[model samples]
Target: MIIPEQTRNNLEFDKLLKWLSSYAHSSLAKRIILKLEPFDSLENIQTRNKLISQCITLINEEGKYSFHGLANIIPILKKARIEGTYLSSAELYTVYRQCLLYSSIKQYIKQNKAIVPDLYALVEEIYEPSDFMRSIKATISEHGEIFDIASDKLLKIRKEIKEIAASVTTHLESFISDKNNAQLIQEPLVLDRDGRYVLLIKAEKRKEINGIIHGSSASGAAYYCELLSTVELNNKLKVIKEKEKDVCREILQKFTNSIRGIANELIINQRRSAKLDSLHCLATFAIEQGGCMAHFNNSSVLELEEVFHPLLKYKSSMIRKSAIVALSLKLEEPARGLIITGPNMGGKTVALKNIGLAVLMAHSGIPVIARRVSIPYLKALFADIGEKQDLMQNLSTFSSHVQNIIPMLNYSEEGALFIIDELGTGTDPSEGAPLAVAILEHLLFRRGLIITTTHHNAVKIYAESKEELINASMDFDISTLKPTFKIIPGIAGTSHAFDIATKLGVAETIVEKARSIRDKKDEAYLSVLEKLSEQMRDLEIKKEVWWKEKNQLEQKLRMSIEENSEQKKLLLEERRKLSERVKEFLRKSKSRWEEVVQEMKAALSEKAYSEGKQSIKEIEQEAETVLKVSIYQDEEPGQFGVND
Candidate 1:
């Protein structure tokens, strides 16, 4: 989205920038945060989301990663790019660190292609040839000290430097140990002074010494002197040291040549890495804030639920985070705008701000702190939230608001979201309220999402009368005389100016007088609104209580049903076992009766049949009683009578 700079400040997107930029590892990333704009294409936005997903994974696993060459090399790179000069050894080391970092990442991405496909794809965009990195690593030490192996001539000259330095050390040691020269020596320590080896000698013995005085001691009692015998050798060493520097520069120049060969690669690498860093920071911010990604659509269908303002979400130390309420605003085809009216300090401004800030954040590709949010991919934002008085230009707040609104009216697109706080507030309501309605009409005609707040009763009444504009309010508790700090949709606030004034210590007599001075029709209208607000407030509280109780009942009912079902299964299992026992008893009775009947028949022929019949009747009666008892036991008290 291409919002104006002033619009950014009005939406307080800078505060969001501060929060996001804290996680940036480089100036490049920080600059990206500052210059954030919505991507021009949906593909680009999805690409960024993919990058963010990878960054989130990386960060959660290993935490913060350092950016190599960020501390000292950025400015040097710029200088090299503009000036085209050979770099020093230390400067080349910085570039080497950068190259090494990217090289390592490239290798990692190549190996873990399946794990981090998006990140690996991003890494593939850079044309980093590892040949220069290998050369630089072989040449430079970890401490930025160029190795002797960097150049052959430099190595040979350094070998000569060591020899010359050894000879000079021998001469200085001999002079200190000499009995004749021992008395002249002060501390007997040889030191390098102005690129020449020198000895601290007594000032009184300076005339006896055959050397040049280089510097005097702080007390002026001794002189720092270089021996006349070692001058030729020192001069030769100086010449070789200069050559060493030239040779080192030549080696560094060779590395610079390697860089220039892949100049385009370096630029591409930096660009891609910088974009990666930016994504990393944004993802870091989103994770910290517990936010989710927002998608875009073509129409002005804005549906935001449970979204907190960025300022309130990020820098709300003074306010309790749990106490801060998330706002919900939806604007569809018929509902083109929302007109919110509420008591002072009742979060109307914050509601308006949340709408604008969320739109901007989504358009800029930073996820919003909402459970679910869908907004139009707007091209511009129109906001008039803050004090816009221009002292130098002699413009009033109304004039400034009008000036901002003018451009918006001319260029505002169909999917734009307009946020106006306390609209029609800077002037007399008699005229300002009508102006606000007229502007609302204009915005409706343009077909955009407009969310505005006002205390003007006329604005609220007009909004209530209109079918297209929805009236909303921040609920306030009349009993406690405090704001509930919640947005209640389809209800207009009473805007109890007199009640608030009285609560703030205005005299009761003054309140009464003010009430008496009002027009009867206006007073009656305000009175009816206050009554409606009370009714709505009570209704909302009751609704909340009802919903809470309903949820609790539902949970309890579910638990009870589950427990009863388990108990019923146990009962059914027990009944099944009892029925099997009854069957077993009947089988045993039949077997015993048959055996007895056989014995009776053998004992007495005439009475055998009658005895068996009696035995059979007794067994049948016993089995019938057992079945009745089992049936009675199977019918549990609640199970038989209560089923939905």
Candidate 2:
């Protein structure tokens, strides 16, 4: 929550803010975004992040909600708070527009509250001034003009002014139509001068016009004069116009008083609207950059999966999405420091800076550009990246770095993140490497979370020897003589300086001489490291292939299960139909037997006693025949039968 200004600059936090500001619709929202800082409490951060997620859901389901016509109405609202201050038509129109925007936003949230409950909660406090908005709408037109229909008195005054203006125009036309006066006129058009209608007359024949001159033209060749006949009419028109102005002023005053009565509510609404706009901007930026909110853990463990630098992904125009490789980092308990080693331009420093930037973004409630992330709630994040040489202070690079690291050491404690780039580089290898190792040890002892990039063998060995430290490296490809820009943990990296020089067209003799000058043990160590790096790359390829095969197998298994389920359902349906056929056959046989019994009973009567035995035999034969036919009709001859 307490990141130094220098650290923020190192991580390019200001540039990130500028990118966020671009998504905002109103100046007020932009201002809020530009001044954003990390929240001090986890609860606040979680709330803000949830709001952004809810906003994204709302947008996906209902399309983007419009925030157009929203302005910074705080100043206007404050001015309206004065007792007798009357806002101009344009000023009042701005407030009216904001009111309408608020209403629309409120309605949108109400309709989609299920999709974005958190977003709705955020705007629930917005005060909707419906009455005030209606008053302004009825009084003012869209072009910031007071309508004549604003009040009956104002309407009557406007009508009277219209009539007087018509009379003046008629008198002027009659005067111009006279053949005698036509010669005196300079042009056949009427000009309005100082709210008075007049005719352009020839300056030389001004004396013959018998009218009072209003003004002269720029060229002094023409005079604008009002005819004596139309003078009284012009006066009436001017008087009526003044009356209309007074009436319009009174109407505006009435509205201004209404605004002052609800000034506090308006201010509250303005703040809430600005907050909603800010959420919109944050959500839009996160969606554009493929960012997600990170889970905050109470422990000191920090994990990042497929994380990209915010500046690289969002700010760089030339870099393709595929070209920007993501970095994965994990620092857990028992290991408080991470020492990264690699050849130059291998992305070691970038990984270090990215860790710091992720922490800052998480604390500030802006989603990080990562597939997944889980970071601790850091109390402070300190980063010393890039060159710190100060020519004005005449300080050496080594001294400058030490000056910056002193505070980091003083404030280093649990829940703090320390990032140092190219550690131990501005001095002699033997002394600088030892110094960097000591700094790492001190920070680790204080339980501080530290990530540093180094090329020093001492620092790398120290990282390997301690259970509280971890060693990581950026990958380099020997075949192409280029860096892969991938960070691999649990292995110390080799610089590959001589090999790189040989590939870069350095003379063979020079490369060989440099190799020979190197210590034998050191060269052998580097050789082993190179072999280890090669093996790691091989293992990564094998893992990728294995994962692809696993996924294919899983897909096949799912299809098989679905096919089996469908077959079972079909089997059950067939059995059901067979059972229905059996039941129907039994019902028909029972009905036939009952009819035969009735025939036997009728034959047993006294008049038919002699025929009883013959009738019984016939009934038995009929029953046997019915049984055979019903069984055969329902299924195969021997497939089913009552006795079977």
Top-scoring candidate (TM-score): 2
Off by over 4 Å in 1: 39-46, 61-64, 68-84, 107-116, 151-153, 217-219, 318-323, 478-481, 542-644
Predicted model with the maximum lDDT: 2
**TM-score, structure 2 vs. true:** 0.85
lDDT per residue (tens digit) for residues 1-644 in model 2: 78888999999999989988989988888999999999988999999989989988887788776676778887887888887788888988998988888878888898999888887887787788888888888889889999888989988888888888888888888888989788888898877888899999999999986788988999999999988877888888888888888887787787788888877877777778888888888888777788889899888888999988988876464454455778888889878788888887677777878888888999999989889999888888899998889999999899988988888889845778899988888999989999998898888877888898988877876676677887778887766877776887766797777878888899999999998998765665565556555655654664455445444433443344435646544543544454455446445645654454354344233333233334334533433333232211225532222221
Clashing pairs in model 1, backbone N/Cα/C closer than 3 A: 1-38
Provide the clashing-pair count of each candidate structure: 1, 0
Give the lDDT of residue 226 in candidate 2: 87
Model 1 deviation from the true structure expressed as Cα RMSD, one decimal place: 20.6
lDDT of 2: 0.78
Tens-digit lDDT track of model 1 for 381-447: 7888877999999999999888888876886566677788888878988999999889888887887
TM-scores of all models?
0.80, 0.85
Model 1: which ten-residue window has the lowest total lDDT?
625-634
- On the 0 to 100 scale, the lDDT of residue 609 in model 1 is 38
Error of 2 at 151 (Å): 1.6
